[model samples]
Target: MWIDKLKDVSFDGRMMHNMSLASLSYLNIGGVAKVVCYPLHVEDLSNILNFCFCFNVPVLVLGNASNTLLSDAGWSGVVISLKHFLTKITVENDSIEILGDIRLEKLLAIASKNNIAGFEFLTAIPGVVMASINGNAGAEKCSISDLLMEYKYMDIQGCSHSVSKKDILCSYRKGPLQTFGIIYSACLKGEMSQKDLIQKSVKEKWEYRRNRQPISERSLGCVFKNATDYCAGQLIEHAGLKKKSVGDVAVSDIHANFFVNNGRGKSIDFLNLIEEVRYCVQNKFGVFLELEIKKVGD
Candidate 1:
């Protein structure tokens, strides 16, 4: 009956049932999503939301899944993915318009080829613009808010609105309209940097991120947020938590704050690893580490 409600709505993308969450996230963990819908356009997303709202079905927005963890028990709701619906990137004047589904890596490549500046720092991150915007992801001391000028998002009622930079309240890794709804697209101001200069900056930053992180491992990047001037990785490493492990999950040897899934790592193991590291860091340094990654599902 729930699936019947969506049957009448016209869709421009794929719809499936019982899709594995493990195959979707970067860590290759998690259980199944009840219903997964990949919408092809803004209208399609609005339709999906409207239908879900009418039927009182819960809606979950997902993207690249680089910075999130789904529960092993799985989600009992409709999971909407903008990956196919909003993946376009366009240039207007000195600003770039990125659809919510656009991957940051693809955006970097597009910007680099066009000799655009101001996004070199984003190369260090690994998620789509939508998820990054949700958490206001950043690197090299620069955040997604730094380049954001205007953005568009649809509310729970399936109504879309465009927002300006000043209207957004940003702090650390938060966007003003973060929890309002699903973001559609964003327009960011860019500067004109030399092609060679952009290339060099990107290369340098990319290399630095690769060197300092466990980039090759199956992990969700940084596991915790910095509590103060000291990085979370440094705090965990200082607390001697690098040797700690829970089943196949372990604090990354490369970056102490990164928890890696060493082949078939379960969500329970990851949770235990977090508990151990959190307790150790707090006891040793008298500082509480905040989680940076989002954990979803029931």
Candidate 2:
């Protein structure tokens, strides 16, 4: 068994058996993860990857679970969550070096305390700093990639590479992680500015998100990628998918693009809702709607 193989490896980290993935995901829905490993540090991450890759153990690299959907049948392989121990953050005058798992909320506080500007736009974003960079998460006409200085990540083979901004090819809601595995750390630049200005910007951004999105609901972020000049929310709304439900999962009435788990939501319901929404949108507009969230498991 794969569990027996993991036991043979010398790992200075943590592991759980048949863990409920719903607890980790924002949607509060998912099935069991057969074997879940949490690395202690970067070296521990490499060790875990090496063991999994060498032993032919199926590896599912997960971070904050903000953009992931796990099937109800459960994951048959090892689920590796890198967030539990990747916790290092350094704030310098010119840059801030942060681990991939550090939350954006904490980074916002760090920027505020250090009088760092240009990070206020990130105050309202969900998940860790790397999540934003991985998906090129954006708002207010700016993206996390715009503020990046450089970043370091690990490939599936556990090899580390430091990439500069020029090397990183980021598009709207897309990032270099398409080819990469796990991000280790990033150095983001911030400028000195008036403290009150920073506070105002953060407040405004927070308010914008609160008003526009279903911030209080259980969702896996945006359901689909934007089409051309129109956002996914607009397309969904135009297709009359708002408030549409399948089982316990329903599209948010406040935002058409956000599919929220009302109560006891299941992955099957989520997938069904996606199909319904996609079918409607495509049939009406003749444009295929692509999913933004990553689906994992059986």
Candidate 3:
């Protein structure tokens, strides 16, 4: 279905059909995408979107897939990945402009190189720039939304638009982003700081994440969003759900909020684990756990 609609578009990036969905996701569990298209440039993306719009082909905009879970039944539409267009970073006095596909880790490194101080807390997040923005990704005291000044994105009609911080609305891990649109690039406000302070803060945060989370393992960063006045990890641990497993997917022993892939894990396993934990936490503490990760495709 998607292929027929995209036949007229000239795609320069990688293209795959019925590709293994697991390889593209952090959870490492999914079936396959009906069509996966990676556009090499903005023009290519525009062309594809135009074609899809004309033919009524469903499109899913994806970044590094770090904060998503794909269904085992796979996706029936077009999955457009922005990985190829991530390039260039421009640092002005008080802001940094970055391409949408850049990884958060790499972006933090760039910030550190430019002596920017606000992005240090994102050093350990494992996803692309757009994913961070789409989910308003963050931890502790800072969110990616806090640094965003303005962003350019293409709507479902293949028309580009710019949005300022005031035009956007976000809550926890959800934002006002449309699934059919693609984020092009964004500018983030950051304070210029001494290299020593930036390095120190980055190192401390990185070290804390390394010690607290199972960073080396295959895992979706966090499973559930913390409810007000309570931590998801703490509540799960207290409910005796730490180290719980469904198939090869297990709750991280180090962080109960993370679900790790031991080996050959499936999306069903992850879903089952989440449901189990949610039920347990609700029954024990009367608290409903909200998912921080986005589940895509079916």
- Per-prediction count of colliding residue pairs? 1, 0, 0
Q: Tens-digit lDDT track for model 1 on 32-138?
A: 88899998888888888888888888888877778888789887889988867746778865678887567888778878888889888888677888778777888
The residue-level lDDT of candidate 3 at 135 comes to: 81
TM-score of 3: 0.95
lDDT (tens digit, per residue) of candidate 3 on 89-143: 8889868997657888888888888888888889788888887887888888778
Best by lDDT: 3
RMSD of each: 1.5, 1.7, 1.5
Q: How high is each candidate's TM-score?
A: 0.95, 0.94, 0.95
Worst-scoring 10-residue span by lDDT in model 2: 123-132
CA lDDT, candidate 2, residue 275? 96
> Candidate 2, which segments miss by more than 4 Å at Cα?
178-180
> Considering only N, C-alpha and C atoms within 3 Å, which residue pairs clash in candidate 3?
none
Candidate order by lDDT, decreasing, is 3, 1, 2
Question: Which RMSD does model 1 reach against the true structure?
Answer: 1.5
